[model samples]
Target: MGTVWPDVRLSDSGDEAPTSPQRSHLIGGHDSKSYLAICSESAVNWLKARVSSADEQSVTDIVTRLSRHADYKSTFMCPPKLKQFPEPDMQMAWKYCQEYFDNRVETLFGAIDRRQFEARLRAHLQDGDNSDSDPSWYALRNTIYATGTRLLLTRTGCDAKTIHESAMQYFLNALSVHTQVLFARQVDLTGVQALTIMSFFAENLLGSSIESMLCSNAIRVAQGLRLNYEPVSNERLSPSDRFVGNRIWWALYCYDKHISLRDGRQSCIDDDDISCALPERQASENPNKFEIFMQMIKSAQIQSLIYKKLFSAAGRRQNTIQERAAVEQLDQALSEWRDSLPLHLRPGAPIKKSSLPAGVHIDPVVYMHYTYYGTVIAMYNKFPWTARGSSLDNAAFGREKAVSAARSVVLATRYIDTDMNTTGCLLFSYPMTALIVLFVHILQNPLAPSAHSDVVLMDMATGHFAQLEFATSMQLEVQFVRDMAHIARRAVEQIRRDAWIDVTPFEAPEPAIFSPTMTGPNLNFMDFLTDDVYAV
Candidate 1:
């Protein structure tokens, strides 16, 4: 592309134009690359001359000229070069910058409007055509996504509101087209476009229109889909698709009103206007509610929508209210037990035992669910649990399922201890059932480690606890057994120790050794534990 220069004539127009016209443009407005270079050069010049006050207006005029070029206006803002420009009075620079940007946006829109860009693009979409199946479709859409976002952010001097509104309209339209393409089973189109759209939104407009655009079903569809272009007879899919899909879907719920691990307001893309989405933290209180909300979304019930549905569906096959009430009783009991622990003593408390910690700690609830149930639920939701003639075998899977659950309990324990905190028994103090539910909730979390400690399992189920055990030990079972011995000796040696409480035997059961038989689908561990053999 050649640079565009303004043609000028002398008052002696009657005379032959000077051998060459005095072209008064910053750099010849030419190809996109050149335009970018010129704009960048002018921006630098404008920045350098500031200290000396050498022709500030002239330098500004050059910048204005660069901004006036069509290609430069579109592509120059987001590249690292523009962002790195020496800090200028951005607000003040707008006086000249505004004229340059206003002209650029007006020109681009004028061309688009005149050419009816949307109308032309819409022609490509045919009913049942499966356009999303074409990778090129997303390639094109991504280009628009990047270009449109750049226009919103870099277009100087434009009303922030107007730019924001226009950007949102384009985003919404893209989302609509994306959904149509996905439902039409153009997997290729939906996959690429959706991912590009998501990546751009996450990277560029994360706080504002991008996130809100995603909050709707658009995010869910984008995350749920696994697009494949490679030919495979046996339904092979790329890891990237599954990974992106799960992340996008998980992110939607991750930020849902219920999840509380992080302040939603804080999670709001800082640049975007998420004031309406994020609740304000009060001055006087800890902003732990958001963390609590994060935990709920990561919970098994929400994470494993399919299993939850199956659990609900299985309810219709049950025999009596007494049987149903038994399960309900356990959940209610667990909830009550959790409520009784002090906040500091609760799961996810700091290992340091200080009034202040350097960084915020993970919410026990979010960490537990996301580690355990979230991983499995996310996987099972996308992949079929049963395929033709492998014949769904819940019976055989039940024991493995129990192992999986136990592993999750162990894993959540490890995660809570290793990653979230190195020196806290906070999660270990939870009731066995709450621990079990929390374990179930996190059984599927991909981020959770497969490895877990046998000792932590023992402590969570036992009542023997001491400050030393609490502060000193990393493994719950080791601490439990240790505490039990000390308690027994103290009570035996001194009646004063007995005044506090009687010593009890340690009854921490080994992992998955005595899983309750599933009465259809729900395992009744309470009944199994209350049985004569387990008691002995």
Candidate 2:
């Protein structure tokens, strides 16, 4: 008899059947080649002999079982219905919409047209809860409410639990209409926008693989509408409409590339298939307004190149010399892109908070800096594992760049003024990656001048994660980081004590211990320590 797989349905109503009866096969095994995976390997190797048996087991659980794939099955279940509540007053509704536009618009690359959306929102409000209203618009409106409410939670001064519950209510309200919009006979751009917004919300709040699935759907819908192609002169769209279309398409493009990179999956939209033009600045618009959005598009393009040239299966097959050349070329491209940014917006440049326009939040600016440094880290993160023999020089260069970039990321978090609970999971990933690098760096050379200071930075990052745990459901991931920090602290203290006498320098675990051939999918805790499964 064939192996039996559990029944998987997409809805509670049992209206959707499983796409395949067999369980989904693991593509690259449970572990991915993402920075987080690299971090896990480093932690396990460093903590192998330093911690108690129970602590070692804890590390093993986090590495082998706490991955996103382990919980991805939950995504197929229908979202539970939120308890009904009175809708916010029209004044509050409009305020929430404004908050989303003022704060989130640039981060999402102007996913919605402000004037057009506001006009539609006014008309929707006039309809006064009519069920006849377009479901796509209804979903989009609620998602805007969800995003805005979460953003304002810190300022509200209400109980954090109350505010979080309210935000989740709005998110569920938007999801209530998702099926209608998804299965509509004639899917429109409005539906695509709704899906995209909801996907963003899901990523930040829900913390699941569902966000990627929703984004893939949005990409498909946009492609079906031919949004990937530049409009011909004969298509007869107004300049404003063309501009909105361009923004939406490029925004989806950026989201697709970033999500793919984050999840270590193939991108849904291929660059070769896209001919959409980048959004152009209108004559009346400030050049500075376009600066962040344009740079983000460029950043996304670079991310796409990085994955294809360095991380992809074909890229991985390249010999040491070829890979080194590719890394150098990509590094130069990234630097040139950074050099092209405005002075204040450039990574590590100090910005006066007062100079920001009224109503504009500092989150987007901070995120841009984080992204730049994170990209740099991502480019060189694999060097310690992959470097050997003739590649040691390249490894040294890569290590220097990666360490500096990681330090910059950890230091840059000081500028985040927003409540950590309200920020997305993506924000935490960068610092965690940096923390891992710092952890390994300390283990390698505990007596380095910066090692003690780096430990302080690691503590700060752990505190940041503690704050984040209040709102996020990703307890396993947060705990993993905290546990690693504990091990690192203990290890460093031991090294400090040994440094007082005639003691040998601490040496990093040999890279051969992490070879994939020595490990497989069914390893026990001790086995895992002996042969790290997360190695590239």
Candidate 3:
């Protein structure tokens, strides 16, 4: 059986009379202890202890419940064959394809070549039902349709429910051919791209674990094709084909690092194994076009290093001094990455609405900041606190960094348009983490000047989730966050009330000591006399 910490016992009556200020005979004045200072310290400590304990149990319960509902196996196994699915609406499909290329495609590290993909799509549509058609191509087309439909949810006249069903139908159509694409003897490049796209679609509907598995499978296939290495100039591949291959490989690399860090799992792609060069902008393209994508890839590299040098099991075994050094090194690297970005793309840089290109979506810009701030929070959120003399000061500095990052995440939400496509989990997870941090801050310092405003920001985040629920089938997760926000609000109110009350200081009763008898076969009575036994 697990042992529980003994509770701090209170007075038998459960209420004690407040003590009057003690007089000092030597100074002929009241004691040096300030009533308000003691009260504040006592309240903060009491709340911190209770909040820490409750957070642990709450997190465990929440994780267990979520795990039970997660569908890990379905993503790996072949999807059930559908007896009947809607015939392709060729015009609508083309429309979605165009929408994807025009707006969404720029945001991702490249996968499909626009001109080549369109020509093939035209031929595929013309060929209609030909036995020679590639199953992988069919899956890729459907995945694009699904992505496009979901992205245009707000622009359509149909009700959100209807639009959502249509999107899922396209996704299901793509998933139905999962086996053909995944189990092919000679893995096609299109198959790898399809799997990559499907994994992202799954992440919005399913969860990170399912997405991780699909991404791992995609990486495996890409590796099988040697996409991890740059193509030789002598190869028969065209310049465009080579560039597309490079883009796809880096896309997989960026995503592998992202999902691994997000899920606390090992990355599928190893930095040591990668020799692929970063994709460059074509001569015909605008010089600044791929800047954001390149920056994201760089950021992902930092994230990979962060997991390797800090969060990995081996890294966790490092001494406090070594850990601090690792953190500082990573922090410097991250700072350099941000600084290397263009002035307009920096984390807190202000964007002029008029300066954005025609039809350009701000989502990518918002995502850059989210990723940057999220990385900052991840670095410091779980930093260790030791018993050394400077530990308290170091902890305070770390906490400040984390809190500042959290605030930045919450503040960035204002830039997110209500009608914007936020079906991705990162869109929700970053703000959710920020909200929880603010919630805890209010609990720890209920009378803080920003406490009331923090509650407002939390409400904004909750409302953001409510909006996103209409775009994606994440009602359960959103509702869970809502319930948590409700509980946090109530806790703030109670803490604030208690803070103002003039109550007696809490004094814990003496703990009852326990002496255990040793009778086990391996027990040695002499062991008790060792210095280690009395160290406690």
> Largest TM-score belongs to which candidate?
2
Candidate 2, residue 46: Cα displacement in angstroms equals 6.5
Candidate with maximal lDDT: 2
lDDT of 3 by residue, 1-536 (tens): 00000111111231533222111111111111111111122323433453445553443332232222232233334445642246356687788888788767343566887788889878877766623246687778887887788677647655545555677677677767777787887676788888888776665553334566678888988887787876863154466667787888888888788766654567899899888788888775544557767887999999999889876779667777888888899889988887777765677544444455444346667677777877777676641211234352246556556656666676567566543344354455567667666655555545554555566767877887676554433333455456446545666666667777422223311111111210001222243223131121
Candidate 2, residues 172-277: lDDT per residue as tens digits?
7777777888888887878888888888776654234566777888888787778888786315446666677677788888778776665566788878888877
Question: With candidate 3 superimposed using the best TM-score fit, by how many Å does residue 281's alpha carbon deviate from the native?
Answer: 0.5
Error of 3 at 17 (Å): 43
List candidate 2 stretches off by more than 4 Å: 1-31, 38-55, 61-89, 105-108, 233-239, 355-360, 383-394, 418-426, 444-449, 470-479, 496-536
**Candidate 2 global TM-score:** 0.79
Off by over 4 Å in 1: 1-167, 183-185, 189-298, 301-536
Ranked by TM-score, top first: 2, 3, 1
Q: What is the C-alpha RMSD of each candidate to the true structure, in Å?
A: 28.7, 10.7, 18.0
